[model samples]
Target chain A: MTFEKWMRESLDRVETALEHFLPGTDIAPAKLHDAMRYAALGGGKRVRPLLCHAAGELTGASAHAVETASAALEMIHVYSLVHDDMPAMDDDALRRGKPTVHVQYDEATALLVGDALQSQAFIALTTAGNGLNDAQQAALVRELALASGSIGMAGGQAIDLESVGRKLSRPELETMHRKKTGALLRASVRMGALAGATPDAAALKALDDYSAAVGLAFQVVDDILDVIADSATLGKTAGKDAKDDKPTYVSIIGLDASRELAAQLSRDAHAALEPFGARAQRLAELADLVVNRVH
Target chain B: MTFEKWMRESLDRVETALEHFLPGTDIAPAKLHDAMRYAALGGGKRVRPLLCHAAGELTGASAHAVETASAALEMIHVYSLVHDDMPAMDDDALRRGKPTVHVQYDEATALLVGDALQSQAFIALTTAGNGLNDAQQAALVRELALASGSIGMAGGQAIDLESVGRKLSRPELETMHRKKTGALLRASVRMGALAGATPDAAALKALDDYSAAVGLAFQVVDDILDVIADSATLGKTAGKDAKDDKPTYVSIIGLDASRELAAQLSRDAHAALEPFGARAQRLAELADLVVNRVH
Candidate 1:
């Protein structure tokens, strides 16, 4: 399939899978369920799931396990966004071109929604045994937990909150983004690869390198878009970093230098995939998509 | 061993195990780490861990696996309390006789702390294979997720929130409490039972009965205490449930009937344990403690 066709199909699959895994609104606690579905089902680039499928294909992993794991990753991502937008955190009023969960629901419901979504993600992940034995399932859960836990996304968020209104050096800024966004992206690649019957260590290492590079590149692009794109295009507030007094690549290293950094990371990502040769074409295409997207 | 000595020692063991499992203050993003430690290590009854340990002992489960699983359950419990005590939720200022997490730290920190604690819990539980094989570990994760997810504790809390300032029938109140408190308590017992090398279906069912009864008994006693106890004894804001117009067993069925219900549940808990005979001596004592504790 063409890369565009492949990407479109993967996004559709992930959206459908997420809908299947999420509790129905008709169930009890309909309000919280509605809020969770509202936050998770909103249209956004299913970038993590796309990365997962690309890596899974290279490793000859079962498509079913990869899809389930991808949905699981998206749930964690959605939960983070829901919690991050709460009044106690970023206090944002909007997300994905609509009202944030806390704004649409009460702050208390938003909190529970985040909690429940995170719980459901773990539940979804345990079903990855289609091509995997029990050990692989445990490994997948452990890796996702590591990526989502204190030293990963949550810790990075803490650093972001602490650094607001303060000048941070380029290295410090990269460190924050690496944890906040990069960790889950990296896990997405690794998790899909893990479902394969045999995951070659060298190939896994190469994929790790590719994931790290793409993760950083994605953040660099996000920083760029926050500066150049309007909210209508970005689906979130434009220039939110500056308004929140949060440091970003554009603020710390200049937009020109930031673009150069993204290009360099993209090149690194491409180089890391040489181990897979033709098998990694989709991943290379994905790297291009991340670095080149306007929004 | 005397039940008192066993109870005291298990509490001590769990406290130390939790300390070992929690991230040290030296970790980067020390503030979030510190807040997690503060919320988790701060003293409480350690009832869930005690329940987990008692259940784990029945089938010759590994001590290491039991301790790790116990810590994981406690982490989830602590995370729930941290989030539930936030200004947006219960708006409580005190817990365990001290300032709540959101009060001791900023709201953002409290939010991150809860998020991190939950992530760490999943990570901790995956270590169940120290005695359990990979399959058992997977089962443990699935069970805990079911207990913690939207249809469980979070769902129950949603019901509680909606029922505030409004009357709920006895059955409605029971359903809410079953999800809120009973689910986790039952999960505590179920997970520990699962740790055993050979868990028979009949024994598991009986334990489930025992867990359900004790779970409701715990909450019924809690509701009774809320009405009659003082804050100094409860280590929380006693009478706050009625003050907030929240429905409870006492509120729905009256205080005297609530006490009778607790006693009946305790008897049922003991009867369910007849299958284990003398092996469930500790659980029997735990049932007595739950129904009889002053606070």
Candidate 2:
């Protein structure tokens, strides 16, 4: 299948798997469930889960195993988006072309929805029962925790808030993105590989290198698109970073250099997957997709 | 040792275990860690950990098996407190005779502190090396997730918020409390048993019964204290529930009957442990303490 086709298929499987785990929407306090579904199942690239599935495929893991990891990663992503859009954070009124949780519901409901989604991510992992052993499950949970906690996304968010309107070095920006964005992306690939129960140290290391490269490349492309695209095409406020006075790679390195850097990182990401031969094609395609996408 | 003395000793062990797991306050973004420490280590009854230890003792589980579960439960309790004190929630300015998290810091910091603490609680469970097999660890994570998630503490909080100033029946009050307060308390005992690998079907059923009875009795006593105690004695805003027009067991059952019900439930809790003989003395004593304490 083509890269886009494979991604669509993988995301479909993930959505189905997640639907099975989510509480039925018919329960009391139906609005909370509605808010959760609105935030989680709404549109996105499904990039994190796609990376997981591709990494797992490269490592010879089964489709089901990769799908479970993908579902878990997506849940974490959804949770972060819900909280990041809250009034205390970015306070954005929209996400993925739709009203954000707080705008669609009240702020209190939005907060609780975020809290529920975060807890539900771990619930999905622990209950995945997709042939992963307990050790694999525990490892996945641990990796995701580190990716989501203060030292990772939360800490990165604090730094981003602190750095608003302030000048930052390239190294400082990279550090912030690495924690805020790269940690979970790296964990996605690692989780997929771990779920296969191969436990190959060298293979895991290579995947980490590949994930780091693509993760940064993904953000660079996002920065480029924020400048080059519009809301109609990007499905959200495109110039939001500039409007918020947040620094971006395109702003720091110049658009031409940023584009060059993205291409270089994509090549590096592809190179890291070469050891897996044809099984790694999806990962290579994903790397290319990360740097080449307009939105 | 008497139950009170045993609880004090067990709580000390739990504190030491928590300190070892938590990052030192000197970590980057020192305020986050400091906030965590300030909220987590502040004085409380340590009732949840005591339940964990008592359950393990009843099941012939060693102290080592229960220590991590104890700490994890306490972390969840601390996280809930942090969030509950947020401006959008109870809007409480104080807790346990000290300024609440938002009052001490800012609303944003308090929100993130709660977020970090919740994430840290699961991190503790995942990384906890208590000799539990992979399945057991997965089960423990799952149990804790359910107890703390929308269907448990978060859900309970939502319902509690909605039910304020509204008359709720005895069963409705019980259901709300079961999820809000009882779920975690019951999970504490169940987790301790699971950590010990002693959660056989019969013992699990017995513990569930014991947990349910004691959980309600605990709430009953809390209600009584709200009416009879002052803020200086309770360390929180006593009578605030009535001040806010929140429903309670005392409101539904009357204070005299509520006390009678608490004593009866405590007896039932103690009786549930008869099968374990003197090994469950700590748990029985805890039931008494729950209903008899001033705070």
Per-residue alpha-carbon lDDT of candidate 1 for residues B1-295, written as tens digits (9 for 90 to 100):
8988998888887888888888898998899999999999958888889999999888777888788778989999999999999988899988898899999999999999989988898888775445567887778888888899899998998988999999898888889988998999998988888888758889889988998999999998998899999999999999999899988888778888988899899999999999898888888889999989998
**Least well predicted 10-residue stretch by lDDT in candidate 2 chain A:** A21-30
- Tens digits of per-residue lDDT for model 2, A1-295: 7776887788798788677666767964567777788888847888898888877876667877777778878878888888888877888887889988889887778778878877888888888566567887888888898888878877777777778899989999999999889989999889888877575788888899999999899888999999999997887778999999999998899999998999899889988988888888888888888887877
User: A114 in model 1: Cα distance from truth in Å?
Assistant: 0.5
Candidate 2 residue A81 C-alpha distance from true site, Å? 0.9
Against the true structure, candidate 2 has what lDDT? 0.83
User: For model 1, how does the per-residue alpha-carbon lDDT over A77-186 read when each residue is reduced to its tens digit?
Assistant: 98999999998788888788999888888899999999999999888877544445778778888888889998899999999999999999988988898899999999
Alpha-carbon shift of residue B233 in model 1 (angstroms): 0.8
Q: Give the native contact fraction of candidate 2.
A: 0.51
Clashes of 2: 0
Q: In candidate 1, which residue pairs get closer than 3 Å at backbone N, Cα or C atoms, i.e. clash? A: none
